[model samples]
Target: MSTLTKQDPFSRLLESAPTNFTAARILAKECYLAQGIPLAKAEEYKFTNVGKKLEQNITNFFNADSFEVSEELIKSSIFEGFKGDVLVFSNGKFLPAHSAKIKGIEVSVLSEKSDLALGSIAKPEKDPFAALNQASFENGIFISIPKKAQILKPILLLFFNQANEGQVIQPRVWIEAGDFAEVTFIEQSVSLGETAYFVNKVVELKGGINTQLHYYRLQNEGKPVLEVSNIESDIQKDARFTSVTISLSGDLVRNNLSFNLLGSNSEGNMYGIYLLNGKSHVDNHTNVDHTIPHAESHELYKGILADQSRGVFNGKIFVRQDAQKTNAFQQNNNILLSDDAIINTKPQLEIWADDVKCSHGCTVGQLDEEALFYLQARGIDKMQAKGLLLYAFAGEVLEKIQEESFRTYCDTLIQERLGSKF
Candidate 1:
């Protein structure tokens, strides 16, 4: 891979796009100029070359001008049996006409005067993709839940993308939950056409004291899309935050998830499931920081790869010196169905507190032939036996989902991906 210079297409695109949040944009621009995009040689990005993928797949990095969504498309795209407030975005632009009136929550578009806590959790200086988002994002949404507010229905964020040519779309989201508030957010992306596109998304979340926040992301954009997403959250005293990511299909996908336990007695949970086939590629990098004492974090990610697809996972847990009595656990497991499939997993733990308890481990293997044979001996078909085993393996993470409708939706998708109706 060659070095990213001023003459590169990405740099030119960055120079041409309009800036948002002036001060932060300037800082992000400076950072981009200083470090440029990460190459394959970079340690943090050794397994996946996101910069190269963006350069090759995206022709117009700043063209999201067309915003059109038919009524039929909107009606057919929503999840079945879902009862919730919906926010619709077409080609990275919010459409109020198609959105529902949200109750007990404040929602608005991001603007120059919007009081933002954007750069506090996910710093622009640390991530180049996030910096690009801060510098070039034209429109975004901000959600605020007041103290003691408990929303019974989940908030659905629907993103629909369609273009005649290859373009890059940037969508930004900021969520703040006040003390003792409870809310759940579900994000789903749909591609309206077969045209190649790139999506760069950044989300920032803040949880106040005793708050409970749940976030779920579903990516099924098919094989013509490349996506890079970043989500950073901060949890306060006695707060509980949970995040679940499900990736079913994509050409090239990379997700960065981070959590900061800034207060004592806080808890953070991360769960992910990726089922890839064809030439698809998916990478997930996560970090959990324990800055105070008596905090806990747990992470479990599982993947199933078939054909010539590839998967990567890197999870890290950090315990600071002052974070005594901290408990952190991380694990990654994968099952490769084909000989050509590949998976690289690394689970890491860094501790500076002697009183902390931390453990990290990873495993990559194929299906158990003995288990398959035993199922077949019991009169189950070969295909059904395989599907049952794989489904049972994935159920460990699927059961973590709290919502019934969403869990069923995910279960159906997983079964379809496995090529079996069981």
Candidate 2:
């Protein structure tokens, strides 16, 4: 047995997992047993020790009998001013009562009869968290958008975690958009109690030709929660896929986002922002692969860390030999607000095509003293001045959000996290 399997939480989670989705579950279990959990020495997890965090924080699998979702709790969890389809999950179990139905789109729980492209894009064999989620997820959500259908309203997925004891929750989401289909998705997570818990989430998205898919994720759980999420997407010919991740607070958080441009003329955009304070820690890792000619990808991630917080950003762009004429750009920037705050940023580009345009860069520094002096000279208080500059620095990535209401909502959260009155 591996060291991970000996852990109480991992063992209990495996033993409690349902035997449904046998094929995928067996494969994922085998892969997880072979790979175990990544250690600090591993190249992919050098900066962020997720395994240690999980071992230290999580104690057991969630006990469903310990908590129940109330109507008031559901109401309070809904996003303000958002009138769209909502799918609510409490303790990783889907709640049909609190969800709304939408026309022209199919939403259902994962089952044997479901027409699923489960392992098409996401390879659990390569990622331990994904493998654990695939092996242990109770019942995940599956969404399908028919060909040529355009849904104007964005779909919201709300995940709430509440437990009396330290536990673990695994949530899985699979989305497929047929050719020429267009849709948007918003995923938000909330913790209901002060107890420490672990959430391992995996999302797989498949886009068909000429399809447009937008995904936005918000992580603002309490400081006692530890979260690790993976989002994998594949875009076909003429399709455009955009993803935005905004992380506000958590004890330990890691986001792994990847996009594969599988067809010509496909485009992918990734934007992320993390505002961390206290002893919070957040890490964002993104990968973009251009496998065909005429594909394009853009990535931008920024962070504002204060107190004893720590942040990490690792982004890579790969252009294969056949990916001629591909254009890719990547950038990561961070600001450390205190001497104890730390950030590790790495932007990498690997291009084998001679006819491609690619660039990658990263920056880590404190707030510009000259700019702060100028603001202070204008009679603005130091705190407000610092807020203004940090907000401006973070606004670049926030502006990439195309949805107006959602953008305003995110702006509000950022301001609050920054403690900016202006």
> lDDT values of the candidates?
0.87, 0.85
Question: Model 2 Cα displacement at 364 (Å)?
Answer: 0.7
The TM-score leader among the candidates is: 1
Tens-place lDDT per residue, model 1, 190-280, is 8887988888889999989999999998999958888888899999999999999999998999999999999999999999999999999
Q: Model 2: which ten-residue window has the lowest total lDDT? A: 1-10
Off by over 4 Å in 2: 5-9, 62-67, 112-115
Per-prediction TM-score to the true structure, in the order listed: 0.97, 0.96
Error (Å) of candidate 1 at residue 377 is 1.1
